[model samples]
Each structure stands twice: as structure tokens, then as C-alpha cells.
Target: MLVDSHCHLDHLDLSDYQNSLDRLLDTARQRGVTQFLSVGVDLPSSSRLVELAQTRDDMLVSVGVHPLQRESPPLPEVTELLSLGSQPGVVAIGETGLDNYYDKDNAEWQEQSFISHLQAGAQLRKPVIVHTREARAQTMAILRDYASTSSGGVIHCFTENWDMAKAAMDLNFMISFSGIITFRNASALREVVKKVPLENMLVETDAPWLAPVPYRGKQNEPKYVVEVAKAVAEIKGVGWQQVAEVTTANFQRLFLP
Candidate 1:
């Protein structure tokens, strides 16, 4: 019943699965990872994910452009986001937010896009999936301004401090941890994990990247989310089964509600 709350299924390198997505998902299912949220980084990717989710009851999706996609011109409008975000199986509004670490020069553009997604989420009554890095202040400010309490969301792959985590939770956002939490140098992140309640937490792999320990050098998949859960459990001083149950419940409460 574990869920990979975030991942890019379409971007996975399926060579080890006989180049078959179904085979890859079956392997994940066999590992107890029965549900997935295949996040979209752009309109084309979003459309493909919606199509992919239509055939599988266990799959859901989020639609929006990534802030690091500086090459994708024109930025997204609220109308554009609403049009696509309203589609079936699209449970959330973004993988969107500020990413000043990679492209600080385009802060204005990213902020505009982020706000549009937030607006769309509010209007559609769907949650937003936020991706934030090195722009915590601006990210939290924009979220505080534009995010509606009724359209609560999750901060996917969170690597920020306890302050930001608490801030996001105060804004009705769950803090999702990825495989990065298992890294040897993530001791600080582990401390953050200890403080975040299981009620406000979710787990993910962000697969095709950031695989957990023992699988760190290998291509990541939804199946490896178990390792992320194991890390959270150890940090929280709880059982992995408890982590799985609580995170799955949190995921359903946020995305499927």
C-alpha cells in the first residue's frame, strides 16, 4: 500500500525492464509500491501523463512547467494551466516553483509561472505540487500570497530547513522527502525528518534519479521508495510499516481528497 508520491514515470530509463513501462510498474507493485504520482514538468509531459493515468487506477498526475525549464518560452498562464489541469486523473497543479540555484537570472519569469499555477489550483480546487530550491524566501512569500487554503499542496522532494518545512505546513502543504534523505551527507536533512510529523509527511523516489543507499548509483524507480521510507522510519524512530501506512494516508488525503 506504499505510494511513490512523486516520480516521472515517462522519463524513466526502462532498459532493465525490457523497455516496458508495464513491466517496470509490475516490479514496483511486487515491492508493495502500489500507487504512483507521475509528475509533469511541462505541457507535453503533462498531457502524456494524463493519458498514461487514464488506463491505470493506481496512478495520478500533476501538471505544470518546472522553473528550471528556462528554454520553454512564454511562461504558463492561469488559463493555460486551468485548461489542462482540469483533465481527468490530473490531481494537482504543479511541479512548479522557484529554482534560483540553477537559474537566478530568470526569477521574475519563474515567479510569474508559479503564481499562475497557484491561481489555477485555487480556481480548480486542486492541490499544487511545489518544487523549490535555493529560493525559499521568495518561494514561501509567493505561496503565502497566492496559495489558497482550500487548494492545499505538497512541497515535493523537500531539502530545506525546519523553518521552511514548518512554514509550508502552516500553509497547508505536506513536506515530501525523496531518496536524498538517505545520503551520507544528509545528516541535517535527517534532523528535519525527525521533526516533521508523520501526519504532514509523504515519500517519493523522483525516479530515474536520486536513488537511495545501496541503490544510489543505480537507476531509481518507484520500487526504491521503500528505501526512502526506511530512512524516514529510522530517523523518526518508528517502524517502516508505520511510515508506509502514514505516508500513504497523507498522500491520499492531499491528492485524492
Candidate 2:
């Protein structure tokens, strides 16, 4: 069985699925995607994710604002993050971290939000789901300062050097690969995947985006995580089945009850 370690379920374009979330998930199930972590990027999405997971045994969730998300009046505070993350079925604290690649001028706000989410994760004893891009140093520094070994997290959609990957592993963070790893231009990322231990790796589609090759430029779904697994298997010189078993286990070990 495969687990989509990260996805934005609410953002999926379900037009072809008769606008039915169940239908989309049914398609994923047929592809051996047995479980999903529907990630949240902000307060509203987090609330929606909690509602979505409430009745689905196979679905779990993470809550926090994305680093690039502009802080609005409704942006969750540290206490609010703690409260939401404490809710049942909320297995992780964030899809949070710094992203200087997008908006360098807002570094201060991003750091504030990132630090708050880390604090919430630390306090609630829940793992965080991090998203770092072009801000590796700041991201690792914040994580090293706040993320305890007991409340470790994963760096989602990793597209970084081996140095960054090693730094994250040192902090007890698993490195999750998305379809981006399957791109022809992602050779460096592929090398990082090769070096990361199987026990410390996870796979995701980040569905509704970053669809793997053969499905690239089309809408992505959890079903396509198998392609990512297949790629990782090839990179690590292991069988695809081994990738499936190990990543599923890693997801459960890190985020499941």
C-alpha cells in the first residue's frame, strides 16, 4: 500500500470526477493509495482539512500557514495553532517554513509565522510538515532551534542539495520527495534521494500540482504517487515494492496514531 504523505485535497480540481471528492479518492484507492495526508496551507484550509478528515479513517491532516501565504487578519496565532493541532486527526503542525525565492521582502513575517508553527509543534508534541525553498539556511536554523527530536517533522517536496538534506536528517526530519524528483532537470534532487536512507524517506504527489512525468502538465492525484515511488526505487537501486512498503511505514511511523 502507498500513502500520499502530503497533498492539498481541497484544492483539487474535481471537475472530471463529477465534482466529487469520493470519486477522486476511489480512483486513488484503485491505484493502491490506501491513505492520504490532506495538508493545509492556512487557517481556512486547516479548518476545512479537519472537517474533511473527521469521518475518513484513511485520511489525516496537518495545520499551518504556508510560508508564502500573506498574513491576514485571520492568520492563526501560535496559541490558535496549538489549539487546532491538538485536535484529533491533526497529526502534524505545519506545511510551514521559509521561502525567500518567492518574496524576499517579507522575510520578517515569514520567520515569525514559521517560528510560531514550530513552537506549536514543539508544545503539542506533533511533527511539523515543512516546505523550504531557497531559504535553506534560515529554515534549518529555525528547525534546529525549535524542533525537538521527540517532535520531529518532514521536509515536504524537497528540491535541495545533499547538504540541506543531511542537515534536515541531522535534526531528525524525514525528507519527502514529490513528483518534482521525476523531472529531467531534477538530477541534483535525484542524487539527494539516492543518499537519503530508506528509513528517512517519504513520497507524496502534492496532488493537484507537480504531477509526475507521463502525467506531467496535467492535474495530479494521489494515484500518481506510484510513479514517484518507482523513480525513488530506481534511484536507490531497490525494487518498487520496497519503496512502497518503506514509505508507507515511514508515514505511519511519523504521523499516524
Off by over 4 Å in 1: none
lDDT of model 1, residue 1: 81
lDDT of 2 by residue, 67-172 (tens): 8788663445999998889888999988889898988998888888888988999888889999988998899888888887786899999998999999998888
The whole-model lDDT of each prediction reads 0.93, 0.90
Indicate the residue-level lDDT of 183 in model 1.
96
Best by TM-score: 1
lDDT for model 1: 0.93
Model 1 steric clash pairs: none
User: lDDT tens digits, residues 63-180, model 1?
Assistant: 9999988778788988889998999999999999999888999999999999999999999999999999999999999999999887799999999999999999999999999999
Winner by lDDT = 1
* Per-candidate total of colliding backbone pairs: 0, 0
- Deviation of model 1 at 195, angstroms: 0.3
Clash number for model 2?
A: 0
